[model samples]
Target: MRTVESRNWYEKSFGEDYLLVYKHRNQHEADRFVQRVIEWLELPSGSRILDLCCGAGRHALGLANAGYRVTGVDLSSVLLQKAKEADSSGCVRWVEADMRALPQDGTLTNSFDAVVNLFTSFGYFETDREQLDVLKQIWMALKPGGRFVLDVLNAGYVQDHLVPFSQRKENGVVISESRVIQNGFVIKEIKVEEGGSRPRFYTERVKLYSPQDMENMLKETGFLLDVMSGSYDGEAYDERRSPRMIMLGHRNL
Candidate 1:
């Protein structure tokens, strides 16, 4: 008998140390990236947008600052609180929830004009059914003709350029990351060492989905493909060279 693999790594992985681990993420860059996305997708001013898996509300706040109504949803309470604290003006609504099952209340279901799942937010589940359920949730959350931006790592690029191990020191901690591609998943083991504290380890595993794989999934989830880009600058997608596979699409009317 086949059973579902437990997929709680994400629930445990995102914590205070994650902020230090992803410290390189820049706000100016997020602003510019979302600006380009707005222009590329032609999202109207004040349109409702759902930032799925919007960790710390970077791009979500970016979109809100650009005059859009934004809802930032993430699973991490630590990150969500950070996002809320940063949003002193209450410009963005922060929701702590898993992507696989979004709020079904009138507040979210079929209420968004667009949805953005940035930073490889997809491909976390252990099975295809669970992954597809996330897409269905995203689809259900959008209004007809709502745009979606799914930014994910390019599988081919990662396979071709997999760095097996790396270590770095930042903010009084030693962070070591080990990467491997196994069982159609990109697995990352992160270890953090701090002063006088035992080393803490966290693991992140994302399914490796190629461009074609995304296309099929999106179509299956009732999304109509619009544009596929390699970068935030709107470069064309190339399987071998693109660092990111950014899929831009829309839910059918």
Candidate 2:
């Protein structure tokens, strides 16, 4: 099975370097993203949830506060530490692990009622097989009747309005953005300006995926494709106009 060998640019870009910046400006947006998922899932109170790629435990803890028993998993120790610190209700369980291959015999194998791959966390793999492997891992972790919700970007729409380059800075950090023409992926170059220290820069890349491609992957993993929308508001997906693509699938019982 193909696995992601090293920590990708995101782990570094969003690690200790950019966490504060994200928390300051982008945190509310993250929360809003989770709220959208919660609404779409319509999960009940105390629902068993596994949040894959649960960064900083924002979504996982948010769901827990709403009364869901949430277990969050990620590969970043620093982010997971922040997650553990922010988990006050004891409702959220934080695990540091790879999403492609989870601890099956450990805490996560076939052990959740709902598995979430939110905020466009589905397409980081360098190849199609690796991406499929990640889906299979998610498939195995869910209970027979479990559900999986994915919030991903609409590649077609993104390419249409694709910004070739942009820049933004806040909270003592500056972010330069660019796109890779080869794959039409977005790359963000972040630089932190600290006193008496040289500026540091890290990069993050996310592949743009089509709805049909994602649905096929889910079906290949034995999940039944349930819903697909363009945005968080339950609108129809136009592929050319929608800013976001959100999909919900279920594992066969």
Candidate 3:
């Protein structure tokens, strides 16, 4: 149900070597995704938000700009550094830590009004239990009646449109891709060939979950289902056409 082993490719690949790739391309896309999450959560100003696995502070920084006290936690020092560089307001409090074993700083125990696990972040753990534990921890991190928002990929759609391999070049960067295999995991291998340099390759393998699987996990973690949307514009979830599986869950008071 979750990823295992020390297979976090982003920690090494997303640093100095590939920061430009992430900053220029992925960051902007992530910003657009965050905007959707913010709109869906609809929390009032001055809310405290915890962004679990806050890669490059996309949503975290955006939330801060929108007037939320944001604490972003991630395992990648390189990404966090980029996040810090892009973080001009100093409004984001970045912490380098694991999502499962959040630091016992006494600062995050039931401290946030909302927690966001965006960009298909829930399935990168080592095992099903570990993945569930991450959800449980998130449940524990929220105040009574707080909300959790997730932007997940539609596994079904991915399988339907499975592309064995592909490539594209942008901003002097050549990106290769591959995907196939399901239920157990979705292996997306992206190879970035930077112009005037050797090609660097990174693979991301994340466990895949169906809507039922996600619903069951959220219920097991004590979160009440709120709404499920297919896209960022508050569109209804359509299995055939939607580009993403965007859903929001709430922790009952």
Q: Each prediction's Cα lDDT score?
A: 0.91, 0.78, 0.80
Candidate 3 lDDT over residue span 25-114, tens digit each: 465677777677778788889999999988788878888887899999988888898889889868899999878888877888899999
Which ranges in model 2 have alpha carbons more than 4 Å from their true place?
Answer: 1-7, 24-28
Order the candidate numbers by TM-score, best to worst.
Answer: 1, 2, 3
lDDT of 2: 0.78
**Which candidate should be chosen as best, given lDDT against the real structure?**
1
Runs in model 1 deviating more than 4 A are 1-7
TM-score for candidate 1, please give it.
0.96
Error of 2 at 149 (Å): 0.5
RMSD of each: 3.4, 4.1, 3.8
Instruction: Provide the clashing-pair count of each candidate structure.
Output: 0, 0, 3
Model 1's alpha-carbon lDDT is: 0.91
Residue pairs that clash (backbone atoms under 3 angstroms), model 1: none
Report the C-alpha lDDT of model 2 over 1-253, residue by residue, as the tens digit: 2334366675565578657556553556667777777787787887789999998887887778777888999988998988888876566888888888888665787888889887767777678888898889888888897888888888888778877776666655565555554565665555556657776766667777677788788888899988888886778888899988888879987
TM-score of each model, in listed order: 0.96, 0.89, 0.88
